[model samples]
Target: MKNVLLVLFLSISMIIIYVFIPQQQSIVFQPNDSNANMAYIPTKEETQFKIKYTHSIHLTDVVESYKITPSKKIHQYELMYEDFSIGMPSNAEEGETFEVLNGSYYIKNMKRIFPFFHLRIGQVRANHTVIFKNVEYPLSHSIPPGTSVKVEIRTLNFIDLWKGVNILESL
Candidate 1:
């Protein structure tokens, strides 16, 4: 009787902990308006991801590399683009370095940190794609074109993860 009771109690406690406690952190993309849906990609600290998009004006590729900090903040550490015009940044900020590497212009050591930011998916020409863990997730796959999204990091438990859409569904 004692052995059976102890086993039951331990099983219940584990289930409760798994359901209520946050086990992992993920990069969550929340819709800015009513036009889109929410999605998430499981991630961990020190993981690197890239948002690659086509420049609306220059028609070139622009890659923004980011790394998640230990505190779960988004750290944008590098920017790579082909040209400088219109909305493109002409030079690196005070502490960053601008250099040309392998025919592409790179702004290394950007050190831009953001708790959250707004991303506007391109309607026509811009194909905004997120590469996480070497998997490509195009926002337009699950979200409507031209939809604006709020990007943020969130800690989630199994229940929350089950409720949210996994952007990797398309993969």
Candidate 2:
């Protein structure tokens, strides 16, 4: 009878301990160290091109512009050409004349659509000419007998994360 009572008491004590004792939950807290700002910073490079041509051609209109801004805080804009031999040849027709105009291709405005995606938009300025013989040549006509211009273009480059680990490791 004593052993039975002792067993019952021990079981009751165990139940009380199980119900009253506070259990600790295991929780883990980790922070992300590689985010867009830290991992995916953009870079820029300067590209050069040498254009040399001599031919009789006609030019009506030429438009040049560039705009690349992945985020509102960062912007990359450039004008037509850095250096040029843009002018009319001395042997142009008696009434032949040309005009070189300087202007901004792409104006920077604070506008951010997608922060991650970036694009380059612009046109490289080139020397061109048009020849009008005995016919009545309008003032708008432009002719270049010879052209030798050095063009420098600036571009924005970003690291693509979707590439495989080997590519990333090489970079």
Candidate 3:
């Protein structure tokens, strides 16, 4: 009975040390001089292109769905289900920023490792619908030329939750 109890106790102790102790002692990303983790920010030079398109307007529907709210410091627009806050914060607008790599269309010419930048904008925080430090420009105007308008753009990401699974959904 004594020998059996000693063996059982040793087995349980080994399992507990193997699973919990090492995980708690491991150090994750080492911090840089700026005190931010190097893993989070883009360390390489990234190329981004600015593209704009004008959506022509008809008199009937041009100004039908527009609501603009101007504040003392900045402007905000409320259209349909979204309320867009325009302009970046004063400090950020002066140019301190960070970004991430996103591929709009996978480029075939370059090596598979490097994806061409179709469009590059500021990185969005987790659980956010809009990109940071970006102006929300509304394409809902029929003005002759240079009429200031507010537009709201939303980016969507579809994640394949079952990548390593054996079966896929039947459609």
Q: Largest lDDT belongs to which candidate?
A: 1
Off by over 4 Å in 2: 26-171
lDDT of 3 at 33: 29
Write the residue-wise lDDT of candidate 2 on 94-115 in tens digits.
3332334463122222232222
**Number of the top TM-score candidate:** 1
How far is 6's C-alpha from truth in model 1 (Å)?
8.2
Query: In candidate 3, where is summed lDDT lowest over 10 consecutive residues?
Result: 162-171
Models 1 onward score TM values of 0.85, 0.16, 0.18
Worst 10 residues of 2 by lDDT: 24-33
Quote the RMSD, in angstroms, for model 3.
19.8
List pairs with backbone clashes in candidate 2.
57-129, 57-130, 129-143, 129-144, 130-142, 130-143
- C-alpha lDDT values of all predictions: 0.86, 0.25, 0.21
Error of 3 at 78 (Å): 43
Report the C-alpha lDDT of model 3 over 1-171, residue by residue, as the tens digit: 999999999999987666444221110112222232111111122111112332122111111121111211111211111111232121212222322223111111111111111212112211111211232222111111222212222111111111111111110
